[model samples]
Target chain A: MKPAPFAYAKARSVEDAIALLAQHGEGAKLLAGGQSLIATLNMRLSAPRILIDLNGIAGLNSITLKGGEVEIGAMTRHAEIERSDVIRKHAPLIAMAMPHIAHPAIRNRGTIGGSIAFADPAAELPACLLALGGLVEIAGPKGKRTVKADDYFKGLYETAIGACDMLTGIRLPAAPAASRYGFAELSRRHGDYAVAGLAASATFASGKLTKVRLAFFGVDLTPVRAKAAEMALAGGDLDKAVAALASDLDPPDDIQENGAVKKHLAGVLLRRVVQQLTETRA
Target chain B: MNEMCDISLTVNGERVSERVEARKSLVDFLRDDLTLTGSHVGCEHGVCGACTVRVNGEIVRGCLMLAVQCDGASVETIEGVSDSGEIADLQEAFQKRNALQCGFCTPGMLLTAQDLLSNDQTPSRDHIREHISGNYCRCTGYHAIVDAVESVAQARKGSRK
Candidate 1:
C-alpha cells in the first residue's frame, strides 16, 4: 500500500532535525528507525506533510553509563538496549523485556524513543520505565526539558511530547543495592503484543522491603504504575503483600481475556514477582 | 503535489540511484524500481515478515520503510544471501525437510532465519521458534521449519569443527 505523499528531509544533526521540525510545525513527523511511523503511514493512519529523518543525526544512538545512572539515547534500538552490557548490569528489567518486543527484525529497527513516543499501552518499555522511575529528556525550540516517566505517558498512543518537541534521551536511575527486578508478560505467541505485562522492582534493606515499584501494561489506557498494589505491599510480608496487591488492581476486559481473567493473572504474576525477589534476597 | 526524492542505496552490494516518490516503500523500490523481486510483500503492514530485508546489517521490514529513507543505507534482500542460484544450507534444509509447501513465505522466512543464525549460530528449538514467530506460515505448521533450522545448525556446527 502506498502512503500519502509527503516531503522528505534528512537532518544532518540533532539541532538540524529540531529546526526542520520547528519549521514544518504540526505537519512534520520525526522519523526515527521508521518502525512505527512508516507502518502508520503505509496504513494511511498518519499523513504527515513532511518527514524529518533523524538517522543522519549524530550522537543520538549512544548508550552511556555515568554517575551510577544509565543514560540511553532515544534513538538507541531495542536490539542495542537488549545487548548492552551496561543495561544488563544496571537495568536488568529493561534487558528482560527487550527480547519480548515484536521480533529480532523489528527490534533491529525500532528505537526506544520512537516506541515511547508512540506510547502504545501494550508496549513493555513504558511500563518498565515507570517501574524504574526513568526520566525523559526532550528538546524543542525552547531548548530542553526533562519529564519523569510517571508524567510522560498520557494515555494510549499519547505522551506529553508536543509535535514540535523531540525526545533526546532517557535516564534510568542506578539499580539500588540489594535490589531484585522481574519482568513477565503473557502473550498468545512470542513477539505478539502482551496480553498483560508486569515490571516489578523491589529494594530490600536489612531483610525488609525498603521500596517497591510495580507497573503494568495492557491493563489500562496507559502504563499504570499499580499504585494501589504498591501501597498494599509496602512494608509487609512478601507473600501477604502479593495477595493484597492482586486484589488492589482493576484489570480491564478485552478480547484477549476478560477483566476477571487478567485480574487473576495479575495476582498470579504479582505473587511470582514477590516470591522471586524474596528468593533472590534470601 | 507528490514530491520526488533522490535515494542512493547500495542494495545487494550494488549501488543503485533512483528518484522515487517520497511515499514509495523500499519493498516496491526493490521489486518495482530496481527489479530485484526476491523480497516478497505479504502483509504490507509490519505484522508479516515476508518483506523483511537487511538494512545496514539489521533486518527490517522493507514494506514499512520508505525508499527515500534508505538514502546512503545498504540493504540486503534474499537475492544477495547466496552468489549461486543454489540455496544456503538453511534454505537447502528447508527444501529437504519440506518446510515450505506454498513457498509464499519462504523468502521472508529465509531472511528471518538468516538473522537468527547470523546472531546465534546454534539456536535451540525454543530460540528458533521465538526468532521466527514474527514470520508466519500458513502451510507446513512450523514443525518442518523447526527441523530445517535444527539441521542447518547441526551442519554448521560440524563444518566449524
Candidate 2:
C-alpha cells in the first residue's frame, strides 16, 4: 500500500525537466498526470530514485488547432480533451474515445501524453492516436525529434521515448471534412480497462470510403493497425473489413479474456464502428 | 528515506500549511495530518473512487496524487462540501432513499453524485450510473443511490420552475 520513497523535483521549464531526466536517466521517472504513474508507484511495480514532476511547467497543457493539424501538449488532462470543442471539431475520433479512458474523476487528472508514453496495450488513447495517424514529439539531452504514431509505440509498457526523453506534444493531421469516426470497447465495467476495443476513422467521399484506418487495443502487445482490414474496406462495405480482422489478428489469451473471445469481441466492435460510420454519413 | 516537502493549500476554505513527505498521498495527508477523516481509502491505486476529492474545482483520486502536487491548490473534501450546505439536498435524498447500508462508501458516493448533478441539470439514469462507475458501493445495490440522485434532480428542476 506504500510506495518506495524517492526524491521529488518540479520542472518549471522543459529544459529543466530534460536536464533532470538526462542526469538521472532510467533512475528517474516523470510524473505526468500521476493517474498511471502513481498507481504503479503505490503498488511497488515501479521504483525510481527521482521523480520529475512535469505539472509545474506552464506551457505544456495547451491544445492548439492550426495549419490543418491539431497539437496537444503532453500535460493536457483527459478531462480537458473530453470537453474541448476544438478537439471535437478537429479530431472527433479522439474526442469519441475520451470517455472510455476512465471515469470523470480519473479523467480530471489523467493525461493524454502520459497515456501514450506509458503505452499500455489496454489503453484507448494509443489506439485512437494510431487511427488518427498522429505523431509524437520528444525532447531530451539531444534536443527535439518527432516520431510518427506508427513508430512511436514499441511494445507492452514500452515506447520510443528514451529514458532521458520527455514526450512534449502529440500532433495529428486535421480530420478531413468528410471524416467520420466510431470508437467502441468491451469492458466488464464502463471505466475499467477494455477487454477489446476498436477505433476507426475514414473519409466518406461520393458514397465510398477513403483513407480508412482501423486500430485495435487490448488484443496485442501494442495497439495494432489493421492495414489488411483497411485495404479490404476501402471503397467497399464494412463487412469485408470485419471479416478481414479474423485474418489480420490473432491475439494470445490474457487474464480478462481468452484469445478466441477477445477476437470475437474485436470483430463485434469493428462491426459496430463500421455501422456507426455508415449510419452517421458524412 | 523519503524527502519531506512543505506544502500550503486551502482545504474546505481554510488556508493550512504543513510539512509532509514527498511520497505522502493527499488522502493520507488529509486523514493523518489534518485529521479530516471524511475521505476514506479503499483502493490506493486510483481505481476505486473512495478517496475522491476536488482539487482546483475538479474531482480527482486523492490517493493517486501526492500532497506536494497540491501546493497552493484548493481542495474540497466530503466534510467541506457537506458543511458548506452545498449538498444538503443530496444528503437528505440519500437518507430518504436509503442509499447506504454500512456507510463506508457514503461520503465518497455523495461527493461523486454531487459532482454529476452540478455538471448536469438533467442527467439520465444511465448517465448517473455511468458517472459513478468508478465509485464502488459494496452495499445498497446502487438502485437506491441512483434513485436518490434522480430525485434530487427532479426537485431542483421543480424549484427552478
Candidate 3:
C-alpha cells in the first residue's frame, strides 16, 4: 500500500533536524531507521506532512563509553549495538534482548533511539533500558535536556519527547558487580511481538541482594517498572522475595491474554528470574 | 506539491539517480522505478520479511523505508547475492533440501540467510532458526528450510580445511 504524500527534508545536522521539526511542528516527523514510522505511515495511521530525515546527521550513530556510562547514539542500529563488545561486556541485557527483537532483518535497520521514541510497550529494549535506569538525551530548537527512563515513557506509543524535539542518544549506567540479568518473553513465533515479557537485574552486595529492578513489557500501556515488586525484594531472599513480588504485580489484559492470566504468567516468570539469579549467585 | 525529489542510491553495485515522490517507499522505487524486482513487497508492513533488502550492508525491510531515506546508501537485493549467475551455497541447499514450495518467500529467505551466514559461518540449528524467524513461509512448516541452512553450514565447515 502506498503511503500518504509527505514532504521530505534532509537534515544536515542535529540543529537542522530540530529546526525542520520546529518549522513543521506536529506536522513534521523525524525519520531515523524508519522501521516503525514508515510502517505507521504506510498504514495511514500517521500522516505527517514533512519527514525530517536524520540519516545525514553526523555522530548520531556512535556507541561510546565515558564517565562510567555507555552513551549510545540515537541512530545506532540494533544489530550494531547487539554486536558491540563494549555493550556486551557492560550492558549484556541489551545484547541478550537484541536477537529477540523482530529478526535479523529488522535489527539491521531498527535503531535504539527509534525504538525508544516509538515507545512500543511490548518492545524489549525500552523495558531493558528502564531496568538499567537509563536516560535519554534530547535536542530541541531551544536547547537540549535529558529525561530519565522512569519518567520518559508516558503511555502506549507516547513519550515525553515533544514534536520539535529529537532524541539524540541514550545513556545507560554500567551494571554493578555481582549483577545477574534475566530477560524472558513469550511470543507466538520468533520475530513476533511478545505476548508477555519481563527483564530483570539484581545486584548482590556482600552475600545480600542490595538492589533489584524488575520491568515488564506487553502487559501495560508503557514498559512498567515493577516498583512494588522491587520493594518486595529490596532486602529479602531470592525465593521469598520473588513470591512477595509476584503478589504485588497486577498485569493488564490484552489480545494476548486476560488480566488474570498475565498476572499469573508474570508471577511464574518472576519466579524463573529469581531462580536464575539464585543459581548465578550460588 | 509538484516538485520531485532527486534520489541517488547505489543498488546492486550500480549507481542510479531518479526523481521520486517524497513518500515513495524504497520497495516501490526498487521494483517500479529502478526495475529491480528482486525485493518483493508482501505484507507492505514490517511484519513480513518479503520486502527485505540490504541497505549499506544491513538487511532492512524495503516496505518500511522511504526512497529518500536511502539517498546515499547502498542496497543489495537477492539478485546481487551472487555475481557469477550460480546459485549460492545456501540457495543450492534450499533447492536440494526442498526448502521452498510456493517460492514466494525464497528471495527474502535467501537474503536473510545471506545476512546470517555472513555473521556466523557455523550457526547452530537454533541460531539458524532465530535468523530466519522474521521471514515466514505459509508452506513446508520450516523443517526443510532449517535443514537447508544446516546443510550449508556443514558444507562450509567441511571445506574450511
Candidate 4:
C-alpha cells in the first residue's frame, strides 16, 4: 500500500503552498493530515503529480478564541478539538460532534479543515458547522476570504476551496449562554460513518424558543440544514418541527438506506435531540 | 520510478535520517528501512489500526502517513515502547486474558490498549471499547481484548493509590 510516485514539498508558508498550486494547478494536491489523500493515492484513485505537504507550516494548527468566536486553524487535529476546553466552552456543538468523528487514532491525524474540504456527506463535522452557522477562512491568490458554512460545501468531495487556495481556519460564532446542543448518529458500528445523523442547537429565552438550527447528514450531497424544521421549531413545538423535516430534507437512496428510511431516521434523531435540548443539562 | 525525499525523525529515542521514496508510507519505512517490524500494515487504508503508532506522542495510522511528512518528528512504534517496558503490565494482562489467538493483531492491539492506558489510567469499559474501535480484532470477538485492557487499567489505577 504505497502511493503512486509523486514529488513532495514541505510547504513553509501559505504563500509557498499557493505558489506551488498556482504552478502545478490540478497536478498538485495539498496534503494535510493525509488521512484521505494518502489512502486515495494508495488506492490509485487519484495521482497528483506533486504533493504540497502542509505539515511543515507552523501556526496552522492554532486554536484562537477572540471576539466571542472560536477560530481554529485548519491544520488542527481532530483530537485537539475534541480535547480543547475552548471548544467545549465557547462552541459546545463542535465539542459534542468530535467524538462522533472516526476513532481516536483517526482523530489524532485527521484535520477539521481536511474534513470540511473533503465535504463528505456522511461526516459529522460539516453538519455541525452548518448547524452552528460557522464560517471557513480560505487563503487564495487574491487574499483571505471567509465563506459561510452554508455556501462553503458545494457537494460530495467538493468545497468552495480552489485548486490554488488553502483552507486556513474555521470561525465559529460563540454560542449563547441560553443555547443548548444535541447530536446523534446511528451507524452500523461505533466508528463507522453514520447511516443517518442529525446535529442541532436551539436557543431559549425564558421559556420561549427563539432560534433552532438542525443539520442532517447521510441524506444529501452536502450536509443540509433542515430550514423548514428550524423555522417550525422556533415555537418550541417539536412535533411540528419533526413533521416539517419531511419537506426540508430530500435524502438520497443508497445501498444502505432508501430516501424514506433516511428521512425517518432524521425525524427519530430530531425527536431524541429536541427532547435532550429541552431537558435539563446532564 | 521514484522521487526521494530527505527526512529526519527520532524513532525509539534514536535520531534517524534517510532518503525515502516520497510515496513510501511510514509503516513501510519503519518495517523496511529501519527494520522495526512491530507495526504491521493492514487495511493500509486507515480503517484497520494494525499500523497504529505514536507520532509526537499521538497515535496515528502509520500506513496513512508518508515518511517524508514526518521530518523532525518523534515516532514511537511498539518496539520502542515495548522495549522500554512501558506497557509490560498491559502485555501481561493480555497474556493472562488471552486477548489474541492468532497473534497477527496483537501488536496493534497492545499499542492501542497502551494508548488508552497512557491517556486515562481509569478509563471506563465503554471508553476502552470506544478508543480501540478502529483497531479491528476479528479473531478475539473483542471481549478478551477489552477484558485485558480493562484489567490492566484497574490494576494500574489501584497501584497508583
Best by lDDT: 2
Q: Estimate each model's TM-score.
A: 0.95, 0.97, 0.94, 0.96
For model 2, residues A1-282, the per-residue Cα lDDT tens digits are 978998899988989999988888888999999998999999999998889999999988889998999999999999999989989999899888988888899999999989999999999999989998899999988899999998988888889998788999999988877888989999999999999999888887677777888999999999999888899878485677778888888888999999999988888998888888767543
Candidate 4 lDDT, A109-164, residue by residue in tens? 99988888888899999999898889999999999999998898887888999879
lDDT of 1 by residue, B44-142 (tens): 888889898888988888887888888899998888876644247888899899999998888989888877887898899999999999998999999
Docking class of 2: medium
Superposed by TM-score, candidate 3 places the C-alpha of residue B146 at a distance from the truth, in angstroms, of: 1.1
Models sorted by DockQ, best on top = 2, 3, 1, 4
Q: Weakest 10 consecutive residues, lDDT, candidate 2 chain A?
A: A273-282
Which pairs in model 1 have colliding backbones? none
The full ranking of all candidates by lDDT, starting with the best, is 2, 4, 1, 3
TM-score of chain B taken alone, every candidate: 0.94, 0.97, 0.93, 0.96
Q: What is the C-alpha RMSD of each candidate to the true structure, in Å?
A: 2.0, 1.4, 2.0, 1.6
User: Pairs clashing in candidate 4?
Assistant: none
lDDT for position A160 in model 4: 94
State which docking tier applies to candidate 3: medium
Candidate 2 interface RMSD to the true structure: 1.8
lDDT by residue for model 1 over A20-64, one digit each (tens)?
Answer: 888888898899878778888888999999898887788988888
TM-score rank order: 2, 4, 1, 3
Whole-model Cα lDDT of every candidate shown, in order: 0.84, 0.90, 0.83, 0.88
Q: Kindly provide the TM-score of model 2 when superposed on the true structure, using C-alpha atoms.
A: 0.97
